[model samples]
Target: MIVVTTPTGRIGRHVLGHVLDGAEKVRVIVRDPERLPAPVRERVDVVRGSHDDPGVVAEALAGAGSVFWLIPPNPRAQSVQDHVIDFVRPLCTAIGDHGVERVVAVSTLGRGITRNAGLVSATYAMDDLIESTGVHYRSLCPPAFMENLLSQVETIRSRGTFFAPISADRRFLTCAVRDIAATAAALLLDGSWTGQDSVPIVGPDLLSYEEMAQIMTEVLQRPVRFQQISGEAFTAALRRAGVSEAWAGGGAAIMAATDRGTYVAEAGSPGPTAPTSFRQWCEEVLEPAVG
Candidate 1:
């Protein structure tokens, strides 16, 4: 059986769908079973609780061979590092106790660049903790999510503008969540690969926010613009939106690292590059969200 965590989340739901289509016996650990579609609940073994709980994870991993892991964000958590550790420790223990063979997890790019990055650094730490367990692991590393723009959909619709902490001309890789999920599902369904490695799920396009604005303008047929803001201002905006101080500060650190080009793929890097271009993502995903 293949166990899936966060089965109703944006990327997890897609991963679960693909796994089911591959005819894998699936089990899901979820906090609220009702949140899942009725058909999904009927299809998988439902362990109704947070995966961070030892009992919950132990129950979910019983007789499971492979797993899809993702840590859901907690905006109100006191510290980002502590929050990540709380979730990872239990899984590390359960992986050994249950004798699971392979694991696939959602992680960020930039492994060797620096450690001062908030979420990026924390996720890299997670990779290490899981690897220390000596199980077969694949870290699905991707840059910024294009769906992050959905947070500003209302602003784009009303003001024809979106804001970011990066420079207007600073280009970076961004991947669609669907592509990330597709890669994860493929790894989970196949049992051939072994050992540990990181897969960079980079999009085919390297785009700046200004260029993204141009594409949005054409795709949405609106006069959209990109407004560059200071990292402090971006953090403050997140704080005002009611996230904890640590969460807000982490957001700033991520943008600061992005501005430093931490997510840029290395020259001739191996592994699969995602095929979704920015223009195609805009036309298909962003335009629909804006509408």
Candidate 2:
């Protein structure tokens, strides 16, 4: 049996689809079962509750051979690291108690760096908490998600400009969520039971925001330009979007770190080959959003 958390999300849904083919039993933990896609909700056992609920997590992990674990960022968290550790520690304990053998956690690149990375700090905490359980674990660490660009689609469509704090020409590694999900599914199904491992899933090539804008413009048949915003401007924009001051500040700091190469991913790590290119992702996913 395999259990997946956050299964309604982009990466989790893909991983669930990939693993459902041959698995005798598959389960998904969701806050609200009714919100899941009809097909997915029907095919898998649904554990209704958040990952913070120990009883729910234990039930989800019961008799499960493998678990795909991911914690969505909470902008409202008092202390992001504490909130993450609070959830992960008990959940890992529950999974262990339930005799779950393997855990595949979704983390991010640049997680080990001690300073200048805000959210990555929390992910590093999660990795450590999961490792202490002594369960066979694999941490899927990918660079910036290409799907994050989707949030700027409206700006591209209406203003013909996509804005970010990073330098438009500074190259950074980027990976598609689908690629991350596929790699994670492979790890779960392979049953290697590697004790503790961190895998960096990089893209075929490094790209800058300007390069990404070019590809997106070509795919959508619109003139799109990358505009570099000041960290202050970025933070204000996030604040206007209803993000809390603390989270907005943290987000701006992370973007600034990326601009300075502090968040740059290391050159190589052992993981699956890049599955999709920026052009491919834009053509297959981004173009449809414009329509």
Candidate 3:
């Protein structure tokens, strides 16, 4: 049996779709079952409760051989550390007690760095907690998600511009969430070998915001430019979008880190290579936005 948390999310949904055909016993932990798509809700066993609920975790883990775990960020969280610890502690204990052997956790590339990557600090702590349980664990340390680029679609359509704190020419590693989900699904289904492993999933190529803008414009057949914004402006924009101050500050910190090259993965790291490119993603996913 395999249990998935955050099954409605981007990566989780992909993971679920990848495994649903092969696995006979697949379950999803969802807070509200009614919110699930009809096909998804009908196909899997739905455990109606929060992943952080001990009883729910135990139930979800019962007789499960593998689990795909992802901790969603709480934008309203007062302190990031406190929110993460509170959420992970119980799930770790439940996994330990419930005899679930293998876990694939979604994390980010800059989690190990101490100076920057403020929000990723929580994922690093989660990796530690999951490792302590003596379960076979794989922590996926992926670079910037290409899906984040979707946020700019409306702006590009209306204003012919994508705004970000990242410099237009600053090259960075970015991977599609689909690739991350595929990697996690492969590990869960195979379950061949794992003790404690951190895989830095990188895209086939490194790209800059300017290059991305060009690709978007070509794919969408519209003129789009990358507009770099100040850190203060970025934070204010996030706050205006109703994101909490802590989350906005953390986002600003991450952008600053990106500017300093802290988010770039080391060359030749031992991890899976994702085949998707920014241009391909734009053609397949982002082009639909303008339609």
Best by TM-score: 1
Per-residue lDDT tens digits for candidate 2, residues 1-291, read 888888889899899888887655888899989878797777999999998788889888888999899887777666666767877976788866888888998987776554656676677889988888888989888877889888987887789898898998898878899999998888888776667888888777678999988888888888888999898999898889888777787788778767877545455433335778889989998888766
State which candidate, 1 or 2, has the greater TM-score.
1
The TM-score measured for candidate 3 stands at 0.94
Each candidate structure's TM-score, on Cα atoms with residue i matched to residue i, is 0.98, 0.94, 0.94
Local error of candidate 2 at 37, Å? 2.4
Q: For model 2, state the Cα shift of residue 276 in Å.
A: 0.6
lDDT of 3 by residue, 19-46 (tens): 8877557899999888788998988999
Tell me the TM-score of model 1.
0.98
Note each model's CA RMSD in angstroms: 1.1, 1.8, 1.7
The stretch of ten residues in a row with the least summed lDDT in candidate 3 is 263-272
Error of 2 at 214 (Å): 1.5
